[model samples]
Target: MRRVKLSDQIAEDLRRWIVRENLGPKDRLPNERALQDHYGCSRGTMREALKALEVEGLLIMHSGPNGGPEVQQTSAEIASRQLRQFLHFQKLDFKHVYELRRSMEVALALNVVDRLTAEHLTALEDNIRLCENANNEQERELARQAEVEFHDILAEASDNPILVFICQFLNGLIRDLVDYRAGSLQEHEAFGARNVAYHKEILAAFKARDRDAVAKAMDEHMCCAETSMQQLDAAFYSDLLSRR
Candidate 1:
């Protein structure tokens, strides 16, 4: 087994303390010297461990007297960033990410269709209008955010916090894939517009409380997204292999 670094072990121990103590946001952690004594590590090693927690957004460091690391509420942004880093490190390509998204999102859509309210429908309509009227790069970004909002709302409507959390986490990855493949924006836009149409159809199904129609629409939408991503991957890998 690979030997874990002392700093890492210190970090893990501190993390356990946070949980065991039920530390809340703004709860002050033990001072650096205290941690050094408790963990039986050097001051430098203790600081390194604290820095890791700080980077993870679990703790914030303050200076001066009464100054120490404090626990912070974890944000979805933090989780998303960590997940993005992990995905990048693993070299999981855009296609694989899309496949994972399609599987989760399609099911989320189906579950949410019957739960959507008039307010939800209105919000979705506004998002589609934004997409339709987007004329510049800034507007296009707003349109993309609106598109994400629509799905996010659907995930929320599913009434499952776990699903909402997962969708929120994955949203950043989806944005990254879209940005990375923007050289194919025109093609993506074409497919995306079709996706908007499918969204409308799913909304209609929702209005009618037609579960089967909703399921079919979601499945079709995911199938199209999967097909497009696969094609893009094929072209990308083919060019890469040709260069080598």
Candidate 2:
């Protein structure tokens, strides 16, 4: 049978202590000597436990007269990075990822249609304009970033934190994939026009609060974008995975 390490046990105890005390991100952990005494562990064991927590992004250690380990609030970006690492190891391609995105985002659109506010609508409109008004390559890339942000905003409107994080993470993965194959897959001018049209259709459906229309529009948009990417580079998905 395997044995648990002393340091790991101490780490678990420290985690429980944080929870029991309801420590917030800004809360500082007790200093090293205090932690060692409280846990009845050696200095080396305390350091190991703290290091483990730090690696998991649960705590950040600092030094100097006023610095020590502080509880670090979990961030979606950190969660997304962990997910990306897992997906990378699986050797997933764009097509594989997009297949999942299509289902999730279609449902998310339907959920958001009735929940959208004027502010949300304005944000979506701004993103569309950002994409439509790009005058140069740099501007166009900014537009692409805005396009990604559009999906994130829509996901947020769903009022489901878990769904929002997942959709945003998928968007991040796609953006990174494109960045990897940057010069090789410059979108055609016509592609931008179609993208804008798709967004407008979806936004119009949301404005009308037509859940079914919003779902259909989102599905169509996803399908068209996937098809366009594949047509532009037949091996785009595989190329992205291979590059990584």
Best by lDDT: 2
TM-score of each: 0.83, 0.82
Encode model 1's per-residue lDDT on 34-122: one tens digit a residue.
88898888988999999999998999999998888999987868887877878877766666766677778877876786688889888
Q: Among all windows of ten consecutive residues in candidate 1, which has the lowest summed lDDT?
A: 135-144
Q: Candidate 2 residues 138-215, lDDT tens each?
A: 665666667778898888777788788778888988777656544555564566678889999999999998888888
Give the TM-score (vs. native) of candidate 2: 0.82
- Candidate 1 has an lDDT of 0.76
Candidate 1 regions exceeding 4 Å error are 114-118, 135-146, 238-244
lDDT of each: 0.76, 0.81
Index of the highest-TM-score prediction: 1
| Residue pairs with clashing backbones, model 2 | none
Q: What is the lDDT of residue 120 in candidate 2?
A: 94
In Å, residue 31's CA in model 1 sits off its true spot by: 2.4
